[model samples]
Target: MNKFGVLSILMVLISVLMFFILRGPNADLPLIIIILGSLSLLGIIFAVISKKWLSGVIGVLSNGAVLVCVFFILLAYGIAG
Candidate 1:
């Protein structure tokens, strides 16, 4: 895989780890959410620019999943709506 692909995968892993870490109380939820959003957005961009098909697709899916989960989590807390 290329540099972008590696970066994309790294972002994916970080986002997932952050998502789980933010699940607890008193964890600065809003800031964590924003960070996660930005990280996933970066992952998506890296994935789009990646030259490898496998990494590109995996990065897109993983990052997209994080974004969707974050959206729903915000909605559940009435923070998005």
Candidate 2:
């Protein structure tokens, strides 16, 4: 894969790991939103500041995946707990 492909895959992997690894009684909606939103914002910043289109593409794609994960996490939280 190319640079953007690698970065996008890595970002998605890391995001999922973070979601699963940080379970807590603090599984509250507010905390989840804060953390995920902040991370997404950071990704946006990285994309904006990147020197290449590859990096920007990776950032945008990764941000999308992160949003998906956030939705799933919120869904899980709503249905079961």
Candidate 3:
């Protein structure tokens, strides 16, 4: 697969896996944020490891997807609370 596809898979997997594995409304929430943060960092690393602009494109798109997810999460929180 291309870099973008791989990156998307990685971040989405982390999001889903973390939610199921760390399901609690206490410390697990912040810990999950940290995990997502790490995935964002990995996106940067992947971009840098590439020899051309393609990797950068993948990183930007992947990070954008994660950000979109985080936005939805915040929206849910605002609505719920």
The top-ranked prediction according to TM-score is 1
**Residues 1-81, model 3: lDDT tens digits:** 466546645665676676678666653444555676667666656555553576566766666677566666656656765
| Decreasing lDDT order of the candidates | 1, 2, 3
lDDT of 3: 0.62
Q: Write the per-residue lDDT of candidate 1 for residues 1-81, one digit (tens) a residue.
A: 899999998998998888787777656767777989999999999999996899999999999998998787767667533
Per-residue lDDT of 57 in model 1: 95
Superposed by TM-score, candidate 1 places the C-alpha of residue 64 at a distance from the truth, in angstroms, of: 0.5
Give stretches of model 3 more than 4 Å off.
Answer: 1-13, 19-34, 41-51
User: After aligning candidate 2 to the native by TM-score, how far in Å is the CA of 8 from where it should be?
Assistant: 9.1
Ten contiguous residues minimizing lDDT sum, candidate 2: 1-10
Q: What is each predicted model's overall lDDT from 0 to 1?
A: 0.86, 0.67, 0.62
Write the residue-wise lDDT of candidate 2 on 1-81 in tens digits: 345444544555666666677767666675765677667656656665664677677777788778877777778777877
The TM-score of predicted model 1 comes to 0.85
TM-score of each: 0.85, 0.59, 0.52
- RMSD in angstroms, candidate 3? 4.2
